[model samples]
Target: MNEKEIQTEIESRVQKKLSDLFTTYKTDTDSLQAILKWKPVVLMIGNYSSGKSTFINELLGQDLQRTGQAPTDDSFTIITSDGSGEGLIPGSTLVSDEKLPFTYFKDFGEQFISHFRLKKVDVPFLENMAIIDSPGMLDTVTEKDRGYDYMRVLGEFAKLADLVVLMFDPHKAGTIKETYTAIRDTLPESSGEDRIVFVMSRIDECDSVSDLVRSFGTLCWNLSQMTGRKDIPRIFLTFSEAMAANPESYSEWKEERNQLKQKIQSAPEFRINHILQDIDRQVNEIKLIAEAMNAVARKGRAKLGNTAKFGFAVSLFVFFFLGVILKGMTGFPEQTFLAALLGGTVQMHHFFVPACGVAGTLLVTSLLFTKWTFPRLRQKARNSLGNLITLETDYRKNLWSKVENRVNELLKNMRISEIWFEHQTNLGKIVKFLNKDLQEFYERIRKIK
Candidate 1:
């Protein structure tokens, strides 16, 4: 399908899956409304001191986000499109300290904390596309508890991203592995519609133009090897500091900056298309799995239902059989024994009493057996049902885990060329092979049901 069509399909699938899950909890209405009004989200992530904040300022064409000569030990500074920045603390808000001016390195640590309560910011950018300015990874001060908390939050938010911009400093070029690990460790295999783009930030720090180009090339190669996505786009070198320092000095840099802006502007739609197709595939997989699991559960429930009916029928049959046996043995009617039993044997004349004795014995035996034996039967049936439910749950979980692992491996092994070709190629043989594989997967799952 074309990009727009694919994107529409993906959005539809995502909406449907979200709708179904939320509907189970009766919360689909609000979620659906939110989806309808959803905007593109771009997440800015990189190691600390990678000029991420500086880049944000450049992007906004103002010193909106804090940038300084040294690294600031702040948590995430989420700048939304609305031109508002706020600190995000774990479970509280500092309403009294809203719109605090960006701080420099000298203003880091508890000094800043004392001035502001970290509350999430809702700004104009949130209306169309939200930009998350995450704390740098691998900061020198590792002991800070808040940094770890910030890392955790960033990881959780990674799933919400449409694109991830990995900003790298040329001076510390060797830490790309650490950078990739920081991101990969936190994100799930199924994070939707996200693309990782490397940015060789602070390019002006390079010795010369040639040095900058070489550095960018090396960065691209290293990232390609590390990510196993050789077809992934090359790194985009940026000099946010230079751009901020003298917006007019480098016309070429300015042109490049504009190009990057255009790329980002178009990336949301580009990614949405791929994400939509992926989501459709994922939804189909999930539906098949769910159906199989439900089938197993239904079978177990049906067996339990039958067992319950059988137990009831057997109990009644036993009671009736006891009545027959008592009538045959005592030469007295079952009703006489019941009446005597109800009347309490206080006036028993010997001959009549003996006549009711057999019925009483048989009735008492049946009652005792039914009371004692049926509990074990019921317990067994319940245990069987419980075991089936547990089995089905475990099976589904394992299957999902396997799928996740396989997909992750596939992504990790994917060559840059393959990803590019995936978009470019229409080789009939490869298409046929993929179709066959998909069919095989469906058949295997059907067998599982």
Candidate 2:
């Protein structure tokens, strides 16, 4: 089949699998639907004068973003293709428009809302993906004075972004404090490390190839300290034509720059894998909740079983104590079945007395177990959910933390007595999505070139 047909089939099967989960488990998937509404986004971030805007202008062959050396732009701009060509939208309109995904940016307040905008230019490459050019990362400590958390906002964008381009230059050498904090604390929090692409822009400004090497080494050192990874990640050495060239060694990195651009062009395909991962993570959350409930249920059942046994034993003991009291007080036989042994005579006609006593004990024990003991055990289990977090395995513990609050909400709105679901029922559905639907979709994508 053609690539388009294969992609359509894969998407159809994915949606069907999601629908099946929604039907069986009653999960909320409005968040996932919201994600699919927007185009795959390539987010560009860097310090001031880092040639970010210049590089984007080269990629689309249009000066879509305003570029200057001294922090010329303070707003976050979204550049997308428009068939009509050259349309500028203000932040207020950008968020308020029902078709856009920036509605959540309203929480950043009117100040940030004023700083966000959308630029539409006629470009065919933008048909598959959109680009976000953010205000340059500054190392200043006056963010509270600015009335917004800059890194926090960037972190949110990183979470939704398909490919995040972190542009640096030889001048900064990765010592941008704000950039370090974003990489150290913010980006990792979003769990989008695999989507990050590091680029050292304006290497032409380094004067010589040896100077460029020194700057690159400094960047590697700083990145190692911040990310705490022993292995060094690949960083593209790139310079836009707007900067002066190192005439001798300029051609050395001629291919790396083109490869970086190629990576940007390939973002839409990367978005497919990201979407699948998001769905998988969501479904796995449901599985975690189901698994936790199942574990709690197993423990609850064991408690009920013990309660049943003990209750019956206590009832029999009480009956025996009552017979001893009668025998001591009025010479009534303790063992009605063996009354003749205790006395000197046998009464075969009095079989009803012993039979009735045993039958009554069993009936009372059964009633107490169902009406009092079992319900109380369920209540106790529900109350101690935090303690019941089956962290026996690493995967369960990690997944449990991700879905902990959701599980609490589920158990809160649901009946604890019924939280224990049939394991294979919900689990089998998850397994089907993972092993069958997802695998088939991936195979189809693989076959499509």
Best by lDDT: 2
Please identify model 2 stretches exceeding 4 Å from their true place.
2-15, 18-31, 140-146, 171-194, 221-231, 245-249, 318-402
TM-score of 1: 0.49
Task: For each candidate in the order shown, give its overall lDDT on alpha carbons.
Answer: 0.49, 0.70
Per-residue lDDT, model 2, residue 249, is 57
lDDT of 1 by residue, 1-449 (tens): 45445445435644643445323212213222222233555667776688887776666656666766566636555445434555444312322223322222112445333433333344443445656676666643562545334443444345345577788788777765665655554343343214666777776667667887788777778777766565656567677646355544444665565666666655455344324323333433344333333433344345445555655565555434544455679965535434445567524442254444444555555554345443443344334433322334433443344344333333333322332223122232223433554344334433443
**Model 1 worst lDDT run, 10 consecutive residues:** 97-106
Q: Report RMSD for candidate 2.
A: 5.0
Please give, for residues 105-179, the per-residue lDDT of candidate 2 as tens digits: 778898888888888888988877888888887666545565677787786676567788889788875446566
Candidate 2's displacement at residue 303, Å, is 2.5
Error of 2 at 211 (Å): 3.3
* Alpha-carbon runs more than 4 Å astray in model 1: 1-38, 81-127, 139-144, 147-149, 182-194, 241-251, 266-271, 274-449
TM-score of each: 0.49, 0.76
RMSD values, in order shown: 14.5, 5.0
| Residue 280 local lDDT, model 2 | 66
